[model samples]
Target: MRRLFILLLLVLSCSSKDTLPDITVKDIEGREVKLSDYKGKKTVIYVWSRTCAGHTEDLKKLSRLVNEYPDYRIISYAVAMDIKDVQQSYQQIGIKPNFITLIDPSVKFNDYFPITFLPSTYLFDSKGKLIASYAGLPEHL
Candidate 1:
């Protein structure tokens, strides 16, 4: 019975790690928004850094997905030094994202999402459960 209890606890802990936490992050305009607010829609979070090259191309691909998958809540989560850095990067790339863009100065979202690399993509279901994750831009979302 004790071993069964331990196994159940381990399962719960592992499963919880796969779900998106209800944490608050700031938008590009510095407005606070809760990640949980997007729970009802399929979410695609593209994590990138301004210093990382080649993200602009991936961003373009994601832009296409934004229009093709209207039902998906696509977000460009920028882990930059500041909002100005992210803005400058966008200007350099000459592309303004059509999807939602959020800023993470200190990378607090890493605690929940565990971003090991720049320009990573995380796909979550409507219920906030992580469905798939890619280290870099995939050929298709």
Candidate 2:
């Protein structure tokens, strides 16, 4: 019975990561953006928190990648986990990022895309399928 339960749990975990969740989140500009909207094009999403150490550096690196790849849809998802003041956090970092930064106060997609580490990035193909997932700053496009 225990063996069967373990196998079920494993399958459930694998099933959840098989695809990206379709959800709408608001960008810093207050524009409603759907995760599926980036379909038919390659998209890279960076889920980050202001409280993470060395996050400013990671944002700088990601910002550069964004500029380097103008054709690819790059997003910077700012999660509100353990965050007290969002504006103050950015101000303290002093790194003004130039990318499409989205805010998820409730972290609605945390279950689909668990943030195991700071500055986690998820890459999706043109078909909106998850191709890769990284735990730190992505150095390449």
Candidate 3:
């Protein structure tokens, strides 16, 4: 029985990291944005907070990657839950203006992203299927 239980736990954990909910989020401009809209393109969805000092480097690296790959779509979601804090972090970190910013107020991401940590990144293929998910800056960026 114990072995069976362990196997189930392992299976659940391994499989849960792949896909994410196609939840709707509000952009900084108050426009509704859906993850599904980015379908048919390589997309990177970054979830980070304003106060996470460790995320600064990852953000910078991601910004550079986005610039280098014009065909890829990168979206940033601020889990800070406050637009003011998000804006302040943006200015402090020097996030480029072209980056699309989304807000996840009410912390609904906990249901889909398993954000026990501060920063998480999800990568999707051209079909909008999740290719991989990482807790921090992945080595390949």
**Which predicted model would earn the best lDDT?**
1
User: Clashing pairs in model 2?
Assistant: none
Candidate 1 Cα errors over 4 Å, as ranges: 1-16
How far in Å is the alpha carbon of 8 misplaced in model 2?
21
In model 3, state the lDDT of residue 12.
81
Residue 23 Cα positional deviation in candidate 3, in Å, after optimal superposition: 1.8
lDDT of 3 by residue, 33-108 (tens): 7756777878887888866657788777777777876787877878857777777777788876466778888667
Error of 1 at 137 (Å): 1.7
Measured against the true structure, the TM-scores of the candidates, in listed sequence, are 0.84, 0.75, 0.75
lDDT tens readout by residue for model 1, 19-95? 77777778878898887777788999989997776798988787898888898999988885578887788888888
- State the weakest 10-residue window (summed lDDT) of model 1: 15-24
Please give the range of 10 consecutive residues that has the lowest summed lDDT in model 3.
Answer: 14-23
Cα lDDT computed for each candidate against the true fold: 0.83, 0.74, 0.75
55-138 per-residue lDDT for model 2 (tens digits) = 777777766787788777787788874323445566676766677777777887686777788778888887778889888766
Which numbered prediction scores highest in TM-score against the true structure?
Answer: 1
Error of 1 at 62 (Å): 2.0
